[model samples]
Target chain A: MSAQPVPLVPVLAVVGIGLIGGSFAAALRRAGQVGRVLGVGRRQASLDRALALGLIDEVVDLEQAARRADLILLATPVGAMRAALEALGPHLRPEALVTDAGSTKADVAAIARAALGERLRQFLPGHPIAGSEMTGPEAAHPALYHGRKVVLTPLAETPVRARDWLTRVWEACGAHVLLMDAERHDRVLASISHLPHLLAAAYMAQVSREGDADLRLSLAGTGFRDFTRIAAGSAEVWRDIFLSNRESVLDELAAFERVLGELRKTLEDPDPRALEAFLEQAALARRLWDGRSAMT
Target chain B: MSAQPVPLVPVLAVVGIGLIGGSFAAALRRAGQVGRVLGVGRRQASLDRALALGLIDEVVDLEQAARRADLILLATPVGAMRAALEALGPHLRPEALVTDAGSTKADVAAIARAALGERLRQFLPGHPIAGSEMTGPEAAHPALYHGRKVVLTPLAETPVRARDWLTRVWEACGAHVLLMDAERHDRVLASISHLPHLLAAAYMAQVSREGDADLRLSLAGTGFRDFTRIAAGSAEVWRDIFLSNRESVLDELAAFERVLGELRKTLEDPDPRALEAFLEQAALARRLWDGRSAMT
Candidate 1:
């Protein structure tokens, strides 16, 4: 879970300096691993706020960032990765390695392959699993990634120097870093992350679409509150995740539907033992997950 | 959210003194609204724990409770209501009103009708909306019901004095008491509570059944943790709820499946706008709910 110390980078660039990117910049600054931080994004107002908050040393264009930064971290929504990578591709100085904090890996990898062309080996796909209901520059904090897992998906041909350096950077930010391939990372995340978000949003939509939505919401207890917490995630971000990780998410959804269908059939006759056994499996599994999670 | 003071009951009995029942006893004791509490349940070990935890003054049989108590709270699972009511029927003296903390109500009312006979009017069906991932007597606390909603479903034939007295007691226990009918309560709860629990359990079952479930779970973050928390609820308890409230829960499930089906089709085309719009609606509604819920 720990990584050896690495030298500070001369200049670091962050694309889409929202919670993830902004927090990364702050954490790296706190760890004294970056000499200067450059922010790049479409939103000038947000970038201004990040600059004012000292999350970044300066706000710069993508071209300037690619030319100057020793490391470039893409933290934009998954949907924007293509354009951002393409923009960063042309002006990249040699040894200017790029990494991303995207939620999914396979699509980002594919996009990087096509967009970065010969520089694809320099593009490391990663997902930093941080929890936040809020977004934007204001929500970013140094401790955002503390004790969190950061999965790095690097192609086989990527330079070990670059991979090991990024791993140390994340570890310096108080993260537990793990190496994974793009396909494996995507498959793991599709089950644990993507499908749950989809289900939560879908459930919320169903409740809100009800004739007595306000009344139903009024009667909602703590269970409803917790179950739908993830449904409040940024819509644009989730849309890109679901679309980019389409096949895996759909497969997970179908698997969930099968279980749901079985439970539905159990409810038809509603055999007491059958229902209890079905519920027991889930309850036991969920309880075990919590127990192990607490240990970790 | 505040209620006027109500005088203490001389003696009260709580059936199945787990989280809900034991917590109610503790809250009533803290409010100085109960002179003594008698616990009744099938598990002697649990009853002993309740006695040791000071959740109950003494352990007693249903007959002893029926004869000695001024009020009785049937806080057992909804499936056990009929058996409890049938047991309490013969020995119940006049004015010894009964209430419940069962999650589902319409079915409880029907069961009360059959089991309690002439004493049906004495039963005041209720549900106290409290949040907890843990259960048993050890989980009981005086503040468990503070600022929480306790919905009371009283029959028209039930005496006004009984309804008013129970409402005052719940308020004294620091709950916001709301008046509702059995059918309406069931429908509302089915939509919010029951459906969410079912979906969570189904999602958990699906994930656990996967070939690489351990790996997927190891990568689970905060979102998955929150979304699946309710799935860890007591299997026996949830089974009873799903069975007792089958019709309403099934209705809610069908409604959810309709929205889910539309989402499935949208995922098929992977249309950006449609997917974004769908997620946007859910995100907006969920955010609004949190804002209002915070105020309440």
Candidate 2:
């Protein structure tokens, strides 16, 4: 497989032309891995902006783009996946490969199963673990996904050829592709990605609602700034994610609350040894992770 | 007061020569504002390290150092403040100015009042809003407090001369000094610094205790890194902080729990508009804070 030459995608349709979609189109165009990149979105102004920025070669309707394309990249929010799949279902080419950049994979897989039916074999569910606080076509950059992890959760019905092709494409855009079960992907993401986001949001909401919020914010420094950075992400995008992966997110939240309660008890009772031990364990784990991540 | 010329201390003693104490000594030395810097700590090895690093001119016992010094800086943890003050109280020079670099001011003020009695008038409680994950004598740098905020929570019994002298000293080290009530300082810190630290520790405890912790940590990226970075802080240090300001921390913890419960409800009920509104408020607040903080 490594020795085989990968063929260029004759035509690529990128739905939702925002940060993820725009970055993907820009990267592929920069690599010259696609013949023509067609951007599809509900907003004509956004599509026009993406075209003007040279992120896409043309703007086309979902049906027309899907009918002419050899590949379709669904980069919309998780809530829009079902409708997007439905719109492309009738005109989707038999040989076209479909993939997505949604945060939640299980829901995307389920939506693909319901909407694509037999065409599900050609669909590969993926999520690139790269983003910024900024969104839209203007925020798009060719190096956004460079040196990032792009996870693929292929359905049981998905073809080996389709998965291999999608892996090659993501590699061309400078991402390392890893394959995992959809359920496992969602659970892993809930612990690392979804949980941190919710915790930051909760912290921001708490601080902002305080009686001395202005004073508190004025005193907040670098630590507060970095910790709440993700809480400033796209609200519409994150809300859709929270609802889409509700069960996993709730499980993680409960785990976090239980630990918080334990910490509160330690603080209230003033157990120096116990509190030190708990904090030491956490600090050790974080340091170990930091050391290992730097190497990898 | 602003027109007054700041007097140079003939001899200065810095108790507990860790990051805060070491940095203070180094910055004063760099500014050429002190005659001789005396380092005080239980550990001779740490004092030797500070002396070798040129952070202090010599090592001396706390009582002897306090008796000979024109100024004293207590840079130990809040838990150690009472014992530190008690040791210095009997031998402290009558004309000496004293201050502390504790994170929580109310407890430190109470400790000083109880320990120093008549000497409390010379003790001005302060907290420098500057630190790194790094600690100890080796981590000390001359520019550590440059462009930072140093908050002073002076007691009603504190002498105006002592407060003014301490403010001038901090300003000489390139810090902006602000004065507030001790109770207000604890509350504001609880909302910003203390609360964020607890949340990060809790999140880290939850994730590290999971059965698939290795996998979860491996998948963790920049967001997770930034969110949990403070969790890697000194265990003994934070444990002391949490216990020192327990009431204010508990109040902030309860507030965070309430907001988190609201977010969980929105997730469970699947209200797009409600979820978006909550997230939008948080995002807007963070962005606004970021903009204002950058300007300041």
Estimate TM-scores for all models.
0.93, 0.92
CA displacement after TM-score superposition, residue A178 of candidate 1 (Å): 2.8
lDDT tens per residue, model 2, A1-296: 24434447868999989889999988887787877899999998999999999989898998898789999999888888899899898888889988999999999999999998888887899999998867899999989988888999988998888899899999989998889998888888999998899989889988988777988888888889878988988898888788888899998988888998998888888788888888898889889999998886
Give all candidates' CA lDDT scores.
Answer: 0.89, 0.88
lDDT, residue A287, candidate 1 = 89
lDDT of 2 at B253: 90
Top candidate by DockQ: 1
lDDT of 1 by residue, A22-136 (tens): 9999998888788889999898899899999999988899999999999999988777889989989999998889999888888888899989899888888889988587889
What would the per-residue lDDT of candidate 2 be over residues B1-296, giving only the tens digit for each residue? Answer: 24434437778999989889899888887887877899889888998899899888888888888789998999887877788889899988889978989999888888888999988887888999998877789999889989888999988988888888888889889988999999999999988998898889888989999999987887888889989988898898888888888899998899888998998888888788988999999888888898988887
Which DockQ-derived CAPRI band holds candidate 1?
A: high
> Best candidate, lDDT-wise?
1
For the second chain, the TM-scores of the candidates in order are 0.93, 0.94
